[model samples]
Target: MMGALGQSFINGITIGSSYALVAVGFTLIFGVLRVVYLSHAAVLAACAYIGYGVIEVTNSAVAAIVVATLAGAVLGVVIERIAIRPVRGQNHLIPMVTSISVAIIIEETLRLTVLSGQPISYPDTFASTVIRLHVGGAEPYFTVGQVLIFALTLALVLTLRVVVQRTWVGRAMRAVADSEDVSSLLGVRVNVTSARTMALASMLAGAAGVLLALSIGAIDAHFAEPLQFKALAIVLFAGLGSIPGAVVGGYLLGFVEAFAAGYLDTSYRDLFAYVLMIAILMMRPQGLFGRRLTQRV
Candidate 1:
């Protein structure tokens, strides 16, 4: 009983940490762009596939992660220039539509070009280690994969925090987030900063995707679709433009899904997330960490 509960909580945190990493990128883009990039999930999926393919060819996860990050960074810049830049000053709705269209195009192209006939598996380098634990009177153990996930997640989060809060680019990003016009007037190069922000966000997403592939041991285009809603729900629940908020929201959502699956049924795992999101939205539209806006007449 107590052991099972403790194990469930640990499982929840592990799943939530991955979600937190992915959600941070989503929240960052929204904070800087002020427009929802629906293609984020698609980009993440593509990066994962690219990483898996590279690993298959070179048999090196490190090499694969590097290549995937570069690819995602370049693709993020391209998407910003072509699909997002032109509609920058315009209403967010236009950019939102454009992003969705780009998502569909990317999805179909991946399906046609990559999965022509066969599917691919993301071979794991640490799949053999087994670690078990006994707590109280119930059964719930941990594995090396779960341990690796936690370590990778912690490293990524710490790296992001340091980069965003300690580095020069981080200062520029904060300035832009504070006020784009002022940042531009002060020689911040708002356009470049915004593009760089998108690139960084994409790289973060790529890292999360690679971690996800490592955990699941398979790569497929459709694999990222489900993540889209879950990631978005976390970001929205935490607050659309708050990075830390997204982290908290993601963990909460992850735990909810894990507990629901463990106690109820696996089929309703996603249902729990959506239901929780809807309930939160209905009760507090501003989200858990979002600031309440004041309108000026």
Candidate 2:
């Protein structure tokens, strides 16, 4: 029993790391743009497919990752300029609706063009590699894919922390998040800052998408839908705009799902996340790290 539990814990952490990547991107976009950016899932899928294509040509995972990240960043800029910028500061519902429409368009386009609504297997880069770790009397193992996910996630998270805490663009992003109007008045280029934020967030999402495809060994057109919901739950669980909260919430959700699947029913794994989400919403709507705002007249 202890052996099984240890194995499950390892699996949970590996999966949770991927969720943390997606959730962090979700929170970053929300913090900067104040929009849900529902098309994030679509962007993820698109980048994954792009990565797959690059791998097919170059057979280099590194090249695929770089190309996909760039593609996602460019897509983010396009989405912002074409779909989001025009709707900025309008009724919040407008941007939300536009994002949904954009998501649908991206999904459908992928379905009709390259993906054909089918599952495409990723190249067998690390599928056969496994690291065996002996912990006590139990032997818990991790796949090379899982190890890469964990390492990349850690690196990305630390890089993001540095960017947010130590860079000029990061400062601009924080200022814009505080108040776009005030930031602009203070000579901050609000448009440029927003664009930079979107690029960074989308690049993260792209990396996540590629990692997910590598982990699962396949890319499916509809793969992003459930992930999108999971990411949303993580964001809400952590607090809408808190980066640290998103990471913690993501791991929490991943562990809950992993445990539920390993010990309970696999079919009910997704239920745990929604249940936790509801519990958090009811108990502390502001989220674990969220601060309640006091409006003044």
| Clash tally, candidates in order | 0, 0
Model 1: per-residue Cα lDDT over 36-73, one tens digit each: 78888778888988887887788777777788888888
Error of 2 at 137 (Å): 5.4
User: Could you say which candidate leads in lDDT?
Assistant: 2
Stretches > 4 Å off in candidate 2? 134-139
* TM-score of candidate 2 relative to the true fold: 0.94
Indicate the residue-level lDDT of 152 in model 2. Answer: 84
Clashes of 1: 0
Residue 253 alpha-carbon offset, candidate 1, angstroms: 0.6
Off by over 4 Å in 1: 137-139
Q: lDDT of all the models against the reference?
A: 0.80, 0.85
Reference-based TM-score of each model: 0.90, 0.94
- TM for candidate 1 is 0.90
Candidate 1 positional error at 208, Å: 1.3
Clash pairs for candidate 2: none
